[model samples]
Target: MKTRNQKGLESKYWLLIIVAACILCMAATFFAGVKSGPVRVIADYTVVPMQKGINVIGTWVNGVADNFVTLKSVQKENKTLKEQNANLKMENNQLQQKAVELERFYDLYKMDQNTSDYPKVGARVIANDGSNWFTSFTIDKGSADGIREDMNVLSGNGLVGIVTKVNAHSSTVRSIIDEVNISSMIMTTFDQCIVSGDLKLINNGVVKFEQLANNENEVAVGEQIVTSNISSKYLQGLLIGYVSEVNVDSNNLTRSGYIIPAVDFKKLQEVLVITTTKQDLIDNGNQTQSDSSEK
Candidate 1:
């Protein structure tokens, strides 16, 4: 039996001997004029196939490298497109927000023009109870900005509420639809009545009014109801709502009905605070009356 090192050495010697034989054969064919024999057959069968295999492997390697480059480029382009799409979505959202803000401002402008006769201040509603409606909410303005308790708050072409609580920089308004508020109002026909704010009635999109002086009165549905001239806290003639349904009570002593509020409490956002209280109007009226009598 041969050792491992002796076997490896014999294998190396045999490989060298084969290489030397092939070289000698090529030399004989080229320079010694030995053509068209076993040497020619050896080159055709062995050397030609070896060269072809090397060329095929080189081509395959080049093709794989090119495919890898193309794949990387496609991935880069896809990533760039994703980034562009995200940025476009962000821009579209910003534009939509701006448009909504612009429309709100335009509506505020219209409200301001409608009540231009009074000394008023514009205020934004900032906070509210976690309900779906603005039943009672806080405004951004307060006593520091001349906001006072009982100051009338208006929105969307009609009266919304009155400031009930005031802080240094914020105030809470109690909407006319708030359950605690009982508004004194007058109809276009000069009939006086009391408006009640009920939670159940608000869900039906109207407030309750009862104690109509005349059940036989010609006040019909769709009659416009405004703040009465006699209301102490709420200024007179500010639109409250329109009459929706009228019915006689069981006692038949009075008539009760519903008024669809002019201001949509659910969509209430901004308001115009008539800075002057109802007391101010009364004072000015009395002062004028006194002056006229003296004259």
Candidate 2:
């Protein structure tokens, strides 16, 4: 009986301790709830560090959003610049082509203006043989176009030279300024002269003119000279050059002068070939005479 009574007493004491602990837990929870209106407390810690962490996280997210927006804007700008660059390149190419076409048209106009008298066939110079003493150039037209040897070759400005050789599709022209070319001439005043191409004289941009006939009037400076009617090679009245200086031989009637050629040989580009046959010349002359008689 005594033992049973002792056990009952111990059980009752344990139940009371549990009840006390439950009450203390409820009191603590009530106090914590009341203080959580503006400041929360768990055990002995406050919520300040958690609030700071939330603020830092929000700022980082906003920064990431701004960076993404900047990157997209840069990509858009890059695409636009690329398109503009391509357009500019296309425009530049078109302008260059236009410039080339204009230059070709100018050359054609010049060629037309220079060959108004003769029925001319225009040809472009394809090659130049400047290394040889007998300097020559090859043209794009030949015998099929009625281009023959010894025919006159004139440039857009004035007389260039004469055709020296002809092929089926091309011809070579030997310029009057070539070392082998010699032309007989007469001064506008009163003297007959012969002009020869000396390489040294051409180096100085002049030709040597030697007077042939005896005359009282010496060849004067600044006198114009033309191809003589007696010349077997060239047509009459074609301008050779003006006399720059006249040097008379001692105890001789003959004199020599320097000739500045009418044509600028350095810039020669396009040339016209006069292919009218010699028989045509005779026919034309006879026709003119008949017409005159009728009149």
Candidate 3:
């Protein structure tokens, strides 16, 4: 039953005694040295083991800290390398696309040099309405670029379609593979025929041609077909396709056949618009209605 002040004094006195004992032990160790005697034996059994344990703990902690620093550096380097790889892949893709575009331009150049020599505006296919066929699609050029409705659109190889709709900045081309699209084509011998689109035939990459003159016209499987002089809408002599199959109808009056189109409808990426329309030629007195009359 001691008072609060009495208990506090007892605690202080015990703390001083412990401190004095600790100082005496430290001074004894300093004077006695650790190389020999009972003092050394006491150090080995007590302070030496404690110091060894502390050194072991410090070594482990330092190793852990160093490992964390190395891990952080490795993660940062990996992130930087991944970003560089992605950027390089993007650059390679861009270069490949540019090369493809350049090749297409060269093809168009050759076509322009060999054919009608008419003025043309080159346009890229911006969008396609059909998935498996080029029945209809939009171009990047339009009226503002001198493109007009019914203007004959040609690819690198031959006829692609005609511009059907035009806006200020873009135009829609109705491809020859469209159901309603038709072309008057003539064989090498001036034998006239009608080339029309059929969804069934186009699925096979060919189109229907009929009314081939039955005079034993001798149309072969590989004969070339071109836009006829009788086509009022299309420019004459534009390559249509090559005759693929030929057979006289049951009536034995006219031959019906199919032609593989000169232009690959499924791969239409760019086209050339012949700015000189058939109507334009007729207006300029370069063509006659008699020549463009439907056969």
Candidate 4:
């Protein structure tokens, strides 16, 4: 709406301000100090404040860049540490398993030496009765390997159980701690005793035994107990366990006690099966007696 003269005046004013700003920028390269009054005032409000704003923006940008780099480095380090921790745990578990395996093998060797009179076959336990302790289990070897029902099973320096069922490919064993009859004898006195399993008391790592003659009092705590020669199914002289407790019955003629089983049922893995049964020995003895009578 203004006339040409008015518009021309306004253009001249803007051109002057631009020229002054350019002159001030060029002067900054050569002069470090401003001594003039008008120039100082203009720089204080305009150029100086603009420089301060630019400095603030640059400092903020630099801080943001540094913080981003630090965050990335921290995340990478955490990931690496977590991976290393997982690997160490896996290695430790493997080492522990190897140690357990070695211990089991050594125990088996000692047991074999103790019962060197019998021919034996080795078998690996395949499955258990779903309890913490292996009260009953199946093995990988069976009829194909000469395994049969009533074959005595051994592990961890003593008797484990007897085979109750046999298949061509696998067999089932009922541990002494299972609900089965066990005929045992004291090694020192050869006194006969009856043994059986109680599921409730087996949690304490022991089984029930009775009919030890109270008159003898010969069976003391810690006495070695083994399968009796008169057992109908299991072979004789296979170590069963050690006596843990003994008490005379109310009738006063018999004593009953608990036996701490030698095998760690919770950790059983491999076992030895005696190929001979008590019935085989009994038949052999009968044959020898008959031959002697004829002679």
* lDDT agreement with native, every candidate: 0.84, 0.72, 0.85, 0.87
Would you give me the overall lDDT of model 2? 0.72
**lDDT (Cα, tens digit) per residue for candidate 2, span 29-144:** 45555645433465224334544677899999999999999999999999999999999999999999889656755755675564456567889888888653335889999989
Order the candidates by lDDT, highest first: 4, 3, 1, 2
Model 3 Cα shift for residue 50 (angstroms): 2.9
- Assess the local accuracy of residue 238 in candidate 2 as a C-alpha lDDT between 0 and 100: 56
Backbone clash total, candidate 3: 0
- The C-alpha stretches of model 2 lying farther than 4 A from their native spots are 1-115, 130-134, 184-187, 212-223, 277-295
Worst 10 residues of 4 by lDDT: 28-37
Mind giving the per-residue lDDT tens digits that candidate 4 earns over 171-266? Answer: 999988888778888999988999887787889888888988877446778999988988888788888889999999999998998999888888
lDDT of predicted model 1 = 0.84
Please provide, for model 1 over 1-295, each residue's C-alpha lDDT reduced to its tens digit, 9 standing for 90 to 100.
4698899999999999999998875664464333577866776666667667889999999999999999999999999999999999999999998998788778778877877888889899998987988999999998889999989999856888888999999999999888754545556577888888887888989998988865456777889888887787887788888899988878878788989988888987888899999898899999999999999
What C-alpha RMSD separates each model from the true structure? 4.9, 12.5, 5.4, 4.6
Better by lDDT, candidate 4 or 2 = 4
- Error of model 1, residue 254, in angstroms: 4.8
TM-score, candidate number 1: 0.76
lDDT of 4 at 2: 70
Error of 2 at 52 (Å): 13
